[model samples]
Target: MTSPITTSSLPEELAPVPATAAPAHAVALVAEVQPFPIAVAGAELEQLAHRLIATRWPHRETAADQGPALDEIRALCDHWATDYDWRRAERFINETGSYRTEIDGMGVHFLHARSPEPDAMPLLLCHGWPGSILEFRHLVGPLTDPVAHGGRAEDAFDVVVPSMPGFGFSDQPVTTGWGASRVADAWIELMRRLGYHDWVAQGGDWGSSVVDAISRRNPAGLRGIHTNLPLVFPTEAEVRDATPDEQRMIAAAQRYRATLDGYAREQATRPQTIGYSLADSPAGLAAWIYTLFQDVTDSGGRPETVIDRDEILDDIMMYWLPNTGASSARLYWEAERDVSGAQVIGAVPAANPVPAGFSIFPGEAVQASRRWVERRYTTVLHYRQHERGGHFAALEQPAALTDDIRTTFRALR
Candidate 1:
């Protein structure tokens, strides 16, 4: 019997693929990337002001933790209407960076920060639901210009933060099928379009899933991936034979799915239905998104205590300004019926052989033990647990996240 072609005697067809091999991209048309400096027309801001002012208030909840406190949201809205500056956020984004390209006829918006260092690494940052590229905004300075941010010049990265289609300033999808898998393809195409032949990616929330998807694709240019939330659902056996540490993680995830996941379920099953309330009322949208920030942050029920009120509002504006309350939720809708039958947007990850690293934040509801992570990521590069931070790592713990990214990729480089 003829032996299968051996690696030692491989012909051209059987030769190893090059490291820079193109990632699979199904899009039919890819247009030239253009400089898309964000500018929310003055009329748009006025319209938002009108919506915020016209909000119909809801009755107070008897229990404080039942949801966003009526007084809290009102106070937030009061400040949003009077003191918050959307123009400042707009100007920062415009001045620092902004770009958009048409992939499959859908406009993909991103912020590209080029490093001044000669041998800087290329990095892609992804964000998830209720989050815009805004999550990674703070990362621009330290990551792209590490020396200026109290880090070594060797750690500088050419960072690309993309607003997943239907979120932030990116155009909403006109049809169905914009799931994690498709977003992964688009991200790969994005890095390629920008001429990044070798690079790494980082993500949290939905961003984790995108990075997971890209890893599974094992595209040529993708050198490594780092995630704050790693998907390591212990097998039924692992659960049955759980260690003390493993049990704690499993229990934490169980508690989250039982109590804190109502919003996810609503978004997953009825994005359109929820979209109506979210799209029409600024107050409704803020409360909906705020519930997450409150529940997931390490702030002990007060997200504003941990994250700046203005920054929180800025994140909310990403959805409110673009009217993405409904559109962005569609990703959850697609994911519920998605890539792997076993993923929770904030819990699970794509299984792959790509060199992988993970940073577990203590307050993040969904997390895996080191063994679980090691089992899934065949080529584990780095893994560590942090004392603070939550699901919104980029926003809640930028410095730690930055340090972890630098450490993880240093080995790869």
Candidate 2:
């Protein structure tokens, strides 16, 4: 058998594209139109709400709590249609130094907040499924000016929060292979386009996967990587010697796959089929994503237990206004071939030899073990387990999440 590759001697197959191969001409950055007014008039919101209240829901079987729980759906719809304010959420995003630029033939929207510190570390942040650029809104002020938030200026970072292609203001790419690997390349190009050479990358969920791909490729001038979710598939030995807690966690994961993996299966296999429902009916869209927010988290109560109504609606609204349900879901459709094939290799084995850090939140799909993670990462500087947050760490625990980024990159600095 081939000996395991050392970090130093890892083959060039894992290396990033040569600098000469990178774009030579400074890509002309095209500015996007400033986003429209965020505040929906109270009367307009009321009218939409009234429509939801009077909505004609479809008939279902008596045993069909298998779908979104009716009570939960009704409660969420009521809050969204009546209580949620898009304008407030919009104003918050706008105030955070948001901007847009065209990259790889798509209009890429992002929030670029420079730290108050003159020598602040540059950081690229990404969000995942059922989320928008809005997820990172709370972390911007704290990250860019840590002193104001009762932290050291030395902990400050110049943060870049980009909406992934096919989501939010970013133009949907009409091509194949926009998976984590492709997005990682886009992010590297995005950083270079902004004239930054060295920077840190961070993400969770799909964002986590992209950053992982980016780090694995060891793109030039990349300082390190940080993620809320780590893809740590267990090895044969680890599985054989699993402890009860590990075993229990594995069982929970299996149960989640059985019940919750349907959406992924559909998105991966035939996103367009369900895309029609999501694109057309506001109620249908809400139910599709609302189930994940409810089931994926360890929230003591409902989604409101973790995310505010307006916040939740704001994320959903990104899909609504753009009608990106089909395009966004197509990401899974594109990735389906890999997920279904046994020939697929685990992401860690394919990892680039960069330093990595993790912040594990509750109710995530896979809570990887440190031992498992260390096998892939050359440097595992920080791994913290938080009691309060769930899968949507950026949204649910921005302060804690921001602190994690500050702490992780401190080692690199």
Candidate 3:
């Protein structure tokens, strides 16, 4: 008779097996031999530029400054059609030891930068809406070699930057369940498959939600969690017993819901309908993503004060070339099922036992007060309020972000 396999007898590859063996982790992290090449040929980019230049823009009211100022859009398109360099960006990404692996029947692309330090902690960093793996580009070098960047080698981290499912090289899931919760499971399996029994997770935007799910679920071997955005469901007493700053923050959040959340609402409810408009027109796609960058900045009058034009365009190009505008937006659509319900708390606050940290950016929706975040997180080791960075903190202030990552993980160590 065949003997039943016990946990001790399980292969090292399955060292951190799931609660149920039925949820097998299929993806494997192959050994990194050399930097993976990504070639966005100059000619192809030129062709895209030509299409933009030839596009017949729709008419807008001359006096109307509503919804992505026409002049700003035109200027941005002109620069993209003329000055931007996709090849250079591709080279930058390739130089960082990027790679692709198949997970859950999807081809997932990620940047895997191993630390020179043998004892370095492994960290999985995720990005959110209107962002990509590119956000963490500057972070790879500093994180993998902290000593070289004015920090101790013990602060080093082996970083993994995966493009969320349906966002980049990762194949779009035909079915549902690729939401934050499912994505968290995929991330845990990814780390386990990579032979990391313990690791850290960090994210912003939709990534924050995914990180929250990972912590709440308390996946085996998760050491700690960090996020730029932490959504805490408020209680009646909390709302009733709010301070002036808390009340002001709540008001700002309410205003955001009223005005700025339309895209989210549509994405959450009718992504397919909205996707049709975004999938075809590159300019349309740029406008949609660009609007967010504009709305969520602390710049006095110019969005450029917060985000670089080329950097913003780089993120826009990911959506443009991958044709993921529609597919990626569907994540919001799938999330609506829970967000629209009367549960009040959206999804359950993760009951994660691991230590958690927060890096509060100035332009984020509303910085979740420490008291509020404490309700959901078991341990809050580090909380820093940035003076200037905005929604896209990784791209806007990479050096500062790298420092935060180092400081937070250093505490966990």
Candidate 4:
């Protein structure tokens, strides 16, 4: 009796509900908040499946350590063509009810879930490159409704998870100047519009940098900050007088820059060059993203070793379906140039003004010594070294990360 709404014929109810009204404070700055849902067209999914089937794969790598193994790519692509379910990922976002709001003339997509607890603290979770709102999907329920997730009612948080510009459902930055610092400013404005005067910030990877920037700014509502991947490097003296662990970490960082940082370097310098391939070829996009997952996760050697194949595919789909290859990569260009005056570049970052917490996940890109971290975050309120989990802590060790967040902010709250 009824047919599904095609992408071309999307009804007003399902479309991006425009923001006709703006708060008093928001009027000065152009802003528009709209109710957004995660719904990719059925035809887009069909196209993705077809592209996966028609991939023009490269020859298998002779050196397994150099890149993703052939067998791994083959298996992943096979599943992408057959068993992967984009709807499941879409359903999760739909259930959570995401929204898109214009801040600084750029559209930002975020999930704002409130807790029943009257005294609940506001928590903002920012994700990095290759990570969307999906990174914190599992953590949302536990953070918002602590009682349901085996925590005290007082530990509840009104969580806000925003997709950085050019990532996920958020609109990509049209002009330049949308680096980490600009994004930080946008987050503060977002919370202000939501009527949150005080909140804590958390992130890993690029998210860590953004949180670090926010902490530096010491925005009106920001209480404290936490990061899984603390962006601190050893000082010259510290490096010279390194402990065995510090030495090991320094070596790892050096190796990463020399070898594993090609993708990053390319993105930083020439994202548009690779953008064509990334936007055109589904297989290329998967491989490009999968390589990072394989290298960063705590999974013996491959990302799938620690995380599920389907989970990885879901993350990949976020990039592929949205055609965000170029836009996402442009973040690196913005970071490299410090387009927004708020990027934490170089080896040693400046000290944070606000209080900070560090959850040092073992599989992070590089390990920083307490001395190194203290140099950047003078008031290190809480510090924990996790035995498991990697760069993608929320996906790999949600319970541990969640516990760390709760414990880190208990005093502040």
**TM-score for all models, in order of appearance:** 0.89, 0.85, 0.87, 0.90
Lowest-sum lDDT 10-residue window in model 1:
1-10
Flag clash pairs in model 4.
Answer: 197-221
Ranking by TM-score: 4, 1, 3, 2
Choose 2 or 3, whichever is better by lDDT.
3
Count clashing residue pairs per candidate: 1, 4, 4, 1
Quote the RMSD, in angstroms, for model 3.
8.5
Candidate 4 C-alpha lDDT tens digits along 23-104: 2212122235555666666677787789889888888887867778777787898899988888898877766656667777
Tell me, what's the RMSD of every candidate?
Answer: 11.0, 10.3, 8.5, 5.5
Model 3 TM-score? 0.87
Local error of candidate 4 at residue 75 (angstroms)? 1.2
Write out the backbone clash pairs for model 1: 231-349
Worst 10 residues of 3 by lDDT: 1-10
| Candidate that would win on lDDT | 1
Model 2 lDDT, full chain set: 0.73
The better candidate by TM-score, 3 or 4, is 4
TM-score of decoy 2:
0.85
Once fitted onto the true fold, the runs of candidate 1 whose alpha carbons sit more than 4 angstroms away are 1-31, 339-351
